[model samples]
Target chain A: MTLSPIQILVIIAAVALGTMITRFLPFFLFPDNKKRPTFVIYLGKVLPYAVIGLLVVYCLREISFSSPAGWLPEGIAILCIAILHFWRENVLLSIGVGTAVYMLLVQYVF
Target chain B: MQSDNLHSPKKPADKRIKTKALKAAFPHTIPVLTGFAFLGIAYGLLMNSKGYGVGWTLLMSLFVFAGSAQYVAITFLTSVFNPLHALLMTLIINARHLFYGIAMLDRFKNTGRLKPYLIFALCDETFSVLCAKEPPAGVEKRWFMFFVALLNHTYWVAGSVTGALLGSTLSFNTKGLDFVLTALFVVIFIDQWKQQKNHAPALIGLLCSTLALVVFGADYFVIPAMIALLAGLALYRKRAEKGETL
Candidate 1:
């Protein structure tokens, strides 16, 4: 798809406006005296987990366990990385290993 | 207050304050910068391949600045120029910012003029940094916030400009370039997971979101899953409180 100059501008403007609306609303609209409700605080604390979960699910949505090059290898890789990450607390190693395993699976095993 | 006094004896130690703030900001930001560099380059290459050049790349990064949304915007602009569709697509892609904003309200309240821009730059990575902790005393919160935004922006612009100029010169397969984002999220999840002793929330999030995705599909699951996760966590909080052996 190729956008003309005008379409590009409109898209940029819309995205910029939408981004700003979400980001700037609380800062501008909420008064300094305002106190967040209890639920808001709870939501803040739990939101990160929810976001991460969403990402994981999103990544795996296209893959299926039924296929040969499917969920078995990728799922194992994800579990391995998650375990290493949880146990050893090493981000680089987990991701590096996970990616390597994934590539291997996609290349030869799966 | 005594602890604050001991840390900042003369003139509030703003000099040391700035350095300490930078130190705190740097570690959390390394992965973000790395990921943005690759993603920005991918975006630039995609844009250039689509016939847009450096001017558009720079302008979009400066004004639009939503990484994934900007990527999707490229496709939308290329296909058709429907204003309503563009608006709706943008809203859907970026709806998570609403939650991010709510998360930041308390921390950003004292940030003064920087607050607006801080909010403007509150991408996923930025929120991870800001919501992690309070800035140390003597460090002007605005300056730290400024550096985080500035650094990420610079990396993105640099990557985009490079991609625009040398889009064809780089011959390596770019199929996996988008994985930078996935890598980044994994890094963040690991970091967040390691910090807390209680892994229940993370586990719950993983299970609930995965289940929701199976039911709702990837594009539509995020907002509803988030709401469900929040509800579940709130309900579990009482049990967590009781289980604490204080």
Candidate 2:
């Protein structure tokens, strides 16, 4: 809390401004009048799928086999999520059930 | 007669169309409500734990809107003052939004006024939700997307404000609650995996990110993972565009 209220606000505003730059920069670069390159278009098409995969891995970065919880909760939870998604084909059910399993394991078993 | 019928019944009033779009958009955002509410509350509690008040948390959620980056910003808030350093960190943390924007360029085209708001509010959850699901047939895409974006934003703000109000005064064991975010991404990944005909891009993302995480370690893995994913996709496009794998 060394920063004053105004300073904290500036920090918040700066983060907001910085994030918007990333969001809007592409639109600015590839305006309607100009043609986006084929490479850019291709990346756009395939990037979403890959990014989500990265996110899944990203979310579990803290895990290590050496840890007491080890990877049991995450491993079982992720497998459960995958299986539930494939079985039920329901996003909400998969996530809801998977998270519940993880919370249970961590709070109770782990 | 067929051609005439095509255009006639579809021309609903703008208000009616908008109401329909909002309805369609809302059901899709229910998962985001649960996810963002948890994450946002954690964020607010963290800020409250650090002595920042409810006002700051609300404003941060309102303007910044980016979830992970906002959490990182809290770390910067307590430290020594350096706007340049904070800005750079914010950009790096949010650089993923650049990829989200690129992926969304086509879908967002012709969205008019909603386009700017869409871009402004393109958090990971919003992007993932919109990217994975399209508006139901007959719903206006622009309004549908607008409502999706608006609803997610609202959930974040509300969750944070509530958490900030309660976090300082209340104490509870909320550990392991953050599993919600991981579950969310896992669900989205599964849905996207099912929706797509090809799985190479998804596998590429998973493998490269896993490698990067091992090699560069987690703290510095994201940018390199993105670069590797970009390169892998670029190489795949060569084969993909040639009709080897559609």
Best by lDDT: 2
**lDDT (10s digit) by residue, model 1, range B1-246:** 335432454655656765676776676567667667667888888887878888889988887777878877877767757877877777777777777777667667666556667777888777776666556666667667766776677778888877777776665445435545665677677777767676777787787777777788767876677767777777778777788721
lDDT of 2 by residue, B8-119 (tens): 4466676688789899999989989988877888788888888988989999999999887887898889999877778888887788788899999998997765689999
Error of 1 at A79 (Å): 5.4
Cand. 2 Cα-lDDT: 0.86
Superposition error at A12 for model 2 (Å)? 0.6
Candidate 1, position B76, lDDT: 75
Highest TM-score scorer: 2
TM-score of chain A, model number 1: 0.65
DockQ per candidate: 0.49, 0.67
Q: For candidate 1, write residues A1-110 as lDDT tens digits.
A: 46667777877788788778767775565556877677777766767655665565555656665676657766767777777777886656766666666666666676
